[model samples]
Target: MQSKATTPTEYIHELPDDRKEVITKLRDTILSNLPEGFEETMNYGMLGYVVPHSKYPDGYHCDPKLPLPFINIASQKNHIGFYHMGIYSDPNLLEWFTTEYPKYVSGKLDMGKSCIRFKNMKKIPFELLGELASKMTAEQWIERYESVVKK
Candidate 1:
């Protein structure tokens, strides 16, 4: 990914006209409710709210390099996606999101270990997204993610 010392403003400035409006709204909702120490960055060509490893170096028992987690906003060929790390690692969180995201669950949503992909911005619940973002620290979320994957 092209890294340019991403700032929230810089990331927003890079978006296309159509995407700028949507991404800006997403950025606003996330920053307004973000927890302390969370940072705005650009990773993998997307806007990432990173909780850097230095912030929680001792939190992970296994992979120390797997820094803290935060939500991400990405622009793709077809649409924009919002990713939530908790969904992949936390069973409780996944179960909750699975139930919460039924409308998009069937064959539309694409996910990796902890990402929720959306083609349309409105498909996600902004309030619920904020709630998820607020619930776990980067360390806590990573530990849970590592633990779940180990099983």
Candidate 2:
């Protein structure tokens, strides 16, 4: 479910007790592993890690007012959703994550183009997710985003 909360802290606090811990952990994982130059903010009603306009003045093409979103974590209706733009934009990153997922979690990876759904909270691979978060820097994401958008 999309949160109406303004800040990440507020978003986590608004979640149900059952979801609060996991989402908090996921937020922490992303924050701890994310490379420099990315800022944490609420984007699209989720806890978003973005390339702020200070780093990329053009902002997101879809809406120039919003920052370049790199990653986002949200508490969904039935599952926790982790969205990573790098995995969606880069085939090699997608292949790497898909190949490595089975090694970390027992169940099949439930994923969309950019969103990874974790139905079972206990099995969420925080470590692997952290690695994925660290894979792309803000500069790299700006380059990748421009490549796809400018095409």
**TM-score, one value per model:** 0.72, 0.97
Over the stretch 110-142, how does candidate 1's per-residue lDDT look in tens digits? 666666666765565666666667777755755
**What overall lDDT goes with each candidate model?**
0.67, 0.93
lDDT of 2 by residue, 1-151 (tens): 7789999999999999989999999989998999999999999999999999999988898898999999999999999999999999999999999999999999889999999999999999999999999998888889999997545
**Candidate 1: segments with Cα more than 4 A from true spot:** 1-5, 58-67, 102-112, 145-151
- Runs in model 2 with CA error above 4 Å? none
Candidate closest to the true structure, highest lDDT: 2
Count of backbone collisions in candidate 2: 0
